[model samples]
Target: MTAAATAATVAPVRSSAGGNAASLPAMRVAGLEFRNPVVLASGTAGFGMELEDVVDLDAVGGICTKAVSIAPRTGNPALRVSEFAGGMINAIGLANPGLEAVKRDYLPWLPAHHPGTRVFVNVVGNSVDDFATVVEAIDGMPGIDGFELNVSCPNVKAGGLEFGADLQALAALVSAARTRTTRPVFVKLSPTLGTGVTDAARVAVDAGATGLTLVNTMPGLVIDTQARRPKISFGSGGISGPAVLPIGLLATWRVSRALPGVPLIGLGGVSTGDDAIQYLMAGASLVGVGTAALRDPRAPERIARQMRRWAEREGVNDLTTLIGTLQWPS
Candidate 1:
């Protein structure tokens, strides 16, 4: 079926931003309601607990925890991150304390500290079964709202991008994960995949993905001229921050247009409220703050405030009205 045909199968569901939009910042995705549309992107926010002292965790919509595997991960070697002109490059290799550790150590702290906030675990693995195993392990853990599959890591099994780039593999992975959990499933797509993102989105939704995370960082490389070696320990890393904003916006537009019914959590170079608004206009149900949060721990709270101000100024009583409202010229 064609993209349009497939999209028509489901109707667009607008989120309920509370009865009086002026008072609340709520949004819904796949029947799950969020306090707002601003979310802390996975990997950048640690487990959402690390920033408890720096910012109000309950101020934003939700938090996506760092990618976790069935077993603990040491992550990439030294020099895992490097800065450049427009953005930063990172090859963290999905480092985490593993599934059991997260549930035992981190999960208990969430409800005590930030009871109102929603938590989504970012699951990473090598094979399809690995993804399923991780999902099954954390399926009913308290304080966890959903799962966001990280299929774009560039330094892991199958080179990370392989699963996201291949339609069959992506479908199988999503399907396996779906069976293992009753909670919502979101597939994070790689920006480097180009047209393959559209195919992957379709297969993922059909296989049981509740929503989509529009992009992961694009692959990049930086060289240390004097040393004649890659700046990052890994030869290449994922490029993020303002440099990929346009790429992320375009990808969000394309995929959202192709899969209108699938909610999207958009991110990439989002540092301000204006940037978050752009993602909403492009069809994202929610916007994610990643690298920006690294620069300012309170970035998500600030962005949420800005979004509210922008909505009031534009006479947008309900912020949801701004979503997918972009007009195309004749």
Candidate 2:
């Protein structure tokens, strides 16, 4: 992107005066400026318009719209979601209104409604070409600041976890999408892949990803003893919530250390400002709120406030200073 185009996408930075710099948690990631660090995770905030009535869209820094596939997805069977002791398990199966519907119904509604809030469309596909095709089709659309490749979705059978797990496949998928648009492309990775997480991150970046969104939902299963069956209709689902917080934090920290300057959107079990602070400290430029927002639409706004308060108390003029500040004992 040219300087003029990049400038257009960014919200202006607040001047620091009288120790007020810490008041604005604004940041620039992958050549795009965000008003704050709190963003609504993908799938949770569908196309922004879905939660417009309940949540204040402008309150959060950005919104990652639901996954959009090449063709509409019917999704999985009944009982797509279930509750568990650790957190929530879901087998949403990447259900969406398809590409054309999004281009017609969703994309235009964003800038007209929530102009200031940055919008990153989540793109999913059944193949590498599918991923590139979606990005190419919507690359220049209005109200879109970037793309989040949903290669890490555990619920989908094809073009999901496999794209993220196989190093060669991941490289090819990212490379294809990279050729489609100049807009930022963030690869969302699976959390279940232990050490491969960093390896995958490296492969993605090398293949032309602008940045990375660490730790998608971990694949898991929940059983009902009395019913002797799975809790969700899909038999198994992606586990999210507080149970995955530590896992996300570790992934963010590890990838951040390995890739040093790469931008990461940290999310898993984030529900509070303090939790977001932990992510920033661990190396995330932004923190995504998913499971918590399902319970409360106002969670993102509340969390952003809490983060500013923490920054004020810590005398941090810029939240970016808190990024990757974790002190590992030698």
Candidate 3:
């Protein structure tokens, strides 16, 4: 990646005159600057506005908002999310107040996207037309820093084929979303095998995706050991949490190396500063926290603080220095 490209994504602040400049430095992801490497994954962090009630928002890298549709979506049925042994299974089908609601309810409250951490909006759709409508709706929504295109939604009726499974479909959808947005577009993909995340990532880049969010959850089910039935009403839901971190790391590393210039926002099961560091070394420019925060709303901030300590302990003053530091097997 070009130095200029790298510089484009980092959020510029006064450079914390008091903090340990001797620790982690600033980093960027696909032209969107981040104060640090720890960001709250979409669907996990509410509009980057709600958390201020618990902690200062200025501390973390960024906030990726919940997935939004062109219009308001009532969302899936009751019993949407269920806890599991090592992770979670969620069937909350893109529930949000929708695009306009975001502007009306969330945008006007924010200060700005300045050194004030990035805010990436997660978008979803059933078709290319669905994507275009969302793109157009959020065109100039205030406080929105960027868009995270959710193309990984499993097609339940299509025998569970992920939108990212077919190269042509993936490229076409990414291109459609890319052409409609002026803000940075971060394409989110599923981890299902043959989804060809790396190949789809190339298409995303070629079609103008600013970066990639590696990965949405994998489709799975919790079977009832006693009843001999599927636990969920839908029979399955997306899996997330610790059980998936290793796969997340592998996916982040593969895509980071494959898509030379594009930035990567690593997410899956990030729960600690060292985990964030590990993702960076594996090629993620920024790391996102999800399921952990589900159990603890303050998880994002906690990780941010932990990252500060981790940076100091490692003797690496700048977080960006750790990007792609790992040597993968040839």
Candidate 3 per-residue lDDT, tens place, 214-295, comes to 8788788987789886666667888999888988998988887776556788889888777888888988888889899878
Tell me the tens digit of each residue's lDDT in model 2 across 1-330.
321223222223662212332235567777777888888999899988889899877778788999999899999998999988888999998999999999999888988987878899999986788898999999989879999998763324343447887788888888999889888888999987787899999888888887889889998999989999999999999999999999999999999998877888998999899999999899998899999999888788788878888878989878888889999999
Q: Evaluate residue 245 in candidate 1 and report its C-alpha lDDT on the 0 to 100 scale.
A: 96
* Decoy 1 TM-score against native: 0.90
- The regions of model 3 sitting more than 4 angstroms off are 1-24, 111-115, 154-161, 226-228
Which prediction has the highest lDDT against the true structure?
2
Per-residue C-alpha lDDT of model 1 across residues 1-330, encoded as one tens digit per residue? 222233222223344434332224566665666778888999998887788888677778788888988899998999999888888999998889988998899767776787667888899888898899989988877778889998764324455557887777888888899889878888999987787788888888888888889889988999999999999999998999999999999889988888876788898999999999999999998899999888898788888888888988888867777778778678
lDDT of each: 0.82, 0.85, 0.74
Q: Which 10-residue span in candidate 1 carries the lowest summed lDDT?
A: 2-11
In the predicted model 2, the residue pairs found to clash are none
User: What's model 1's overall lDDT?
Assistant: 0.82
**Model 3 clash pairs?**
9-31, 9-32, 9-33, 10-33, 11-33, 23-317, 25-318, 25-319
- Candidate 2 vs 3: which has more TM-score: 2
